[model samples]
Target: MRIPSLKLLQGFEAAARHGNFSRAADELCLSQSAISHQVQQLEQQLGQPLFRRVGRGVELTVAGEVLQQSVRRALDNLQGGLGRIAGYMDPGLVVLVCPAALAQGWLQPRLAELRRALPQLSLLLSTDESARFVDEIDVDIVIADRPLQQPDVMERRWLRDGWLMAAAPELAQRLAALPPERQPSEAGLLCLEDGFTDARAGELFRAHLAGFRRVGIYDDARLLLDAALRGEGLACLPKLLAAEALADGRLQAVAGYPAVDGAQYWLARIQGQPRAAIVAEVYAWLARQTEEA
Candidate 1:
């Protein structure tokens, strides 16, 4: 059997995948007319119509559908093989997605140690606020709050518990000075944005505190901590972000308040891919950091 022209096969494959000559042409960097001509030539050679015009787009014929399935599988196998070869040669390119606050307060300081440990590895970090890590972004690892289990991804609980709490030395003093019945009403309160509270920090203030004035609401934890430091009011902050402040006497834990549960951080990887060496190293580093923290 004679093999078809590679260019024509490529054009047909792209057109079939995209279902439009214009899109296929864009992918191949060819004009739409050129892609159409190539597909027509291939169909003529095969003595069959591969696609049928349907409204504004084309739909694959039975033969075209079969060819498309084969082409998709071939492309996937080729990509996987190339990735494996690249990994073998370098094993250094690691892409990670982490929460913005963690990336700023916790992970940034420790990155030097990671680089020292894996001198050859290149790190690419992306910030993701969403609990669900999108696989389409092509990250090697994602650090996020544990969500319901996702298929084809391995989830490991990095931090067992964490929480958001409002605290400051001055506010603590004020609260201590206030009478028991009036303290909750007069105490300054800082609230984080609604999304953060819902995902990580359960609604604790509604149950514990009485009517209170909103001092401020902030999006970034670091900024919130700064406000707390400035005595702008009590800011609800993550324990990890406020740990240093608490130690240095800039902040104090509010007494008689129920302990808020810490948000569990998770490390996730798509199942079945060979773990990149750098990703494994970073994961270990994060685990150690959590343990030390």
Candidate 2:
């Protein structure tokens, strides 16, 4: 018997999995007619009617069901084997996902250390605010606020802390001249807009600045820090990101106020999967770095 086309099998698998040609087409980025054609070709090659028409849709026949299971298992095994080989051959490719702010303020600065520590490793980083892991994309690690919901994933807490009110030294000095109650209102306030809802902001504003006015809302911590440095206003920022500034006397924490307990950062991986040497090394390094920072 002649070998059937792998592409045709893939099309059929997608259609069977979704139970809809339109959905399969959308996923494969092909026209519905094209997907239907491929399925037709696949059925022709197999010399069997794979699908039975039923009220605006199609259901898999008994042969089709058997073929679908075999195809799925074969494809999964093929992909898994390829991934294992790739992981062995190119162990350096570490795909990571993190929040944008964490990527910029925390990860970027220490990436050089990571590179030096794992010289053979290459980094591919992406930002996903919502926890969405693409299994096929080969993401080995993720630095996120919460654990991934996917089964068989393990999460390790890297940093569990909160936000503190910070202001430039000069701005602090100026605020010191005003009455304690009026200092926040008289001074500028730099707000981090990312991951904040209107209700959360309102609550935070009410708690932190009962009488203070919001001068600016910034999406980036770096920008907020810059504004604070220029004596713009006080900014509420993660202690991890603002640690250096706080230590350098460039920014001082507003004393006598309660700090907000933000979500912790987690390093995640597939539970049963053996960690690649480089991935293991990087994870350890990140843990140490966060601890020291």
Candidate 3:
């Protein structure tokens, strides 16, 4: 029997892990349809149905579950082997992966502190949200909104963030003066599209202020913040990301709106890989940063 390609197996593994094609595609940095097609090809080659559509998501069939277990094991073995070798090859080099907003709004500003804490360690930071430990690439650590649930990864909740609906001071003043029951028809809603920064923007808007019109969708927190600063629209943004703007009066919190619970940031490291002393030092420093945050 001909063996399926590694890409096909990888796609199948990601889909099975996420149980949703779109999420799997996000993790693997592939288009949703591409992941779907790859999984379909794998099923065709195996001559068995792997996934059953359940509403908008998917459920694994018995065969799919069996295949998933095996696929996970096989991929884990390969990743572990490569990680072990890579760990020893560059013991002082540490790689960290996280969303761009986190890197920009949080980590970048604190780089000097990290460098001072681990003066001997070399740091490489990747802002790609798709970067994870399971792939063949070298990623020693990750800071993500979601906890790393893979058995081979160790995670610590780095920080809990909150989001506030905010707008430019002028806009906030206008909205605040409106009658209690009057909706702010002059302002439009701004949100992130496929946002990884704080994945609850839409939910927050829907739960608290669904009457507002959605006028703009961006893929970056900075863009949303910029739009709000320009008086283009109101946006729900991480408190930390907008702290400077709010303080300087470029943006102001929407009157009477409470902060929404944002996703927790996790500091995670891959397990079973060689742990250098520098890695431990860096991890400790990161934990301290969270404590201070």
Give each model's whole-structure lDDT. Answer: 0.72, 0.75, 0.78
Model 3 lDDT, residue 286, Cα: 85
Q: Give the local distance difference test score of model 3.
A: 0.78
> Order of all candidates by lDDT, from best down to worst?
3, 2, 1
lDDT of 3 at 198: 40
Which lDDT tens digits does candidate 1 get at residues 113-155? 8889888877777786553553523676788866537777776
The model with the greater lDDT, 2 or 3, is 3
Worst 10 residues of 1 by lDDT: 129-138
Candidate 2 local lDDT, 19-64, one digit each (tens)? 8899899999999999999999988888999988877677899999
Candidate 3, superposed: residue stretches over 4 Å from native? 1-92, 134-137, 178-183, 194-203, 247-249, 272-275
User: Whose lDDT is greatest here?
Assistant: 3
Greater TM-score among 2 and 3 belongs to 2
Better of 1 and 2 by TM-score: 2
